[model samples]
Target: MNNKRFVILASIAALGLSGCAGYREKRGFILDEQLSQAVQVGTDNKTSVERTLGRPTFTGQFNDNEWYYVSRSTSTFAFRTPRVIDQTVLRIRFDPAGNVTAVERTGKDKIASIDPYGRTTPTLGRRKSFFEEFFGNIGTVGSGGLPGGGGQ
Candidate 1:
């Protein structure tokens, strides 16, 4: 009976520890080094590149000639926000003839973190309490009416 209780407690502790373990996740297009390297500028066209590296993650906003293959790896511990550990943005640019013009790659140096200000957002207007806002518009609604429009 003691052994059984010990086993049960140990199992529960193991599961709890597992929940606290850091989790790593691979998101978006997972690039293959060899496959990505095989794509050569001036040699690989749209069709060939597509066949070699699969479809791109997304195309350029303005033109379809530029393609972006983005890969990111993230890690999260417990209940924290997932942080990017590895990032790769491979941009393949094509010319008018659809041949690869340039191959560019960017790493995690481009990642940006934005933290909002405080619990309340700062606005352009003066701050007012709840009751003030609820009753503030009562007198202002009729303040702009015509002076001589008193129902003749």
Candidate 2:
């Protein structure tokens, strides 16, 4: 009996440990150093860039000349919020004729931290209490009767 109980407890502990193991996920474009290096400014055009790096994750909203390749790795353990382990943003600028003009790379150092002020957002309207809202429309709604009801 003692040996059986010990074995059961050990198995449970092992299962729990396995459940706590962290998982890493890669999101967005996969960047290869060789492929990226193959692109040359003023020489590689839009077609060549697409052939080398595939489609970009996103293009500049106002202008299509700027292409962005984004890659991120996130890690999560159990139910905890996933944390960004690594991130890279590659920006390729193209001229009006669609020739590559410049290439830029950004990493995790560019990430920004923004903290929200509060749970509620301020709005532009009269505030009413629960009781006021529940009863405020009680008299106004039926006083005039339903539209086109024709008073009998």
Candidate 3:
């Protein structure tokens, strides 16, 4: 009986530890090197561009000749609190002849054009809670004492 209990307990602990086994590395964008090699007009082809870099996130809606490579790195903790570290958008335009016509990079400095509104305005920060403002966190965690009782 003692050995059986020990084995069960060990198995449970091992299972718990296994859940945390996937160690994710700190991901970041290596954009500087890639951006330096500008897409020369009337030289780079679509196939060659894709081979050199990677698939573009977006293609121009009105025209099929334009390509946009949007690269961004976001980080979050236990909760999904996102923090954008780096963002780079490389816009490549192709001529009627299907060769690279223009290439421009839009980074932090040129982000204003991306969003006409620019940065989000800061609120007063005094946010009204769901419970306090509406119902409230009055009852305990597992308690079934609220208005709509036994649903969960």
Better of 1 and 3 by lDDT: 1
Error at 69, model 1, angstroms: 0.6
TM-score of 1: 0.72
What is candidate 2's lDDT per residue for 21-110, written digit by digit as tens? 889999999999999988999899999999999999999999999999999999999889999999999999999999999999999999
> Candidate 1 lDDT, tens digit per residue, 41-113?
8899999999999999999999999999999999999999999999999999999899999999999999887
Pairs that collide, model 1: none
Better of 1 and 3 by TM-score: 1
Clash tally, candidates in order = 0, 0, 1
- TM-score (C-alpha, index-matched) for candidate 2: 0.80
Candidate 2: give the clashing pairs.
none
Error of 2 at 14 (Å): 2.8
Worst 10 residues of 1 by lDDT: 143-152
lDDT of 3 at 77: 51
TM-score, per-candidate, Cα-based? 0.72, 0.80, 0.48
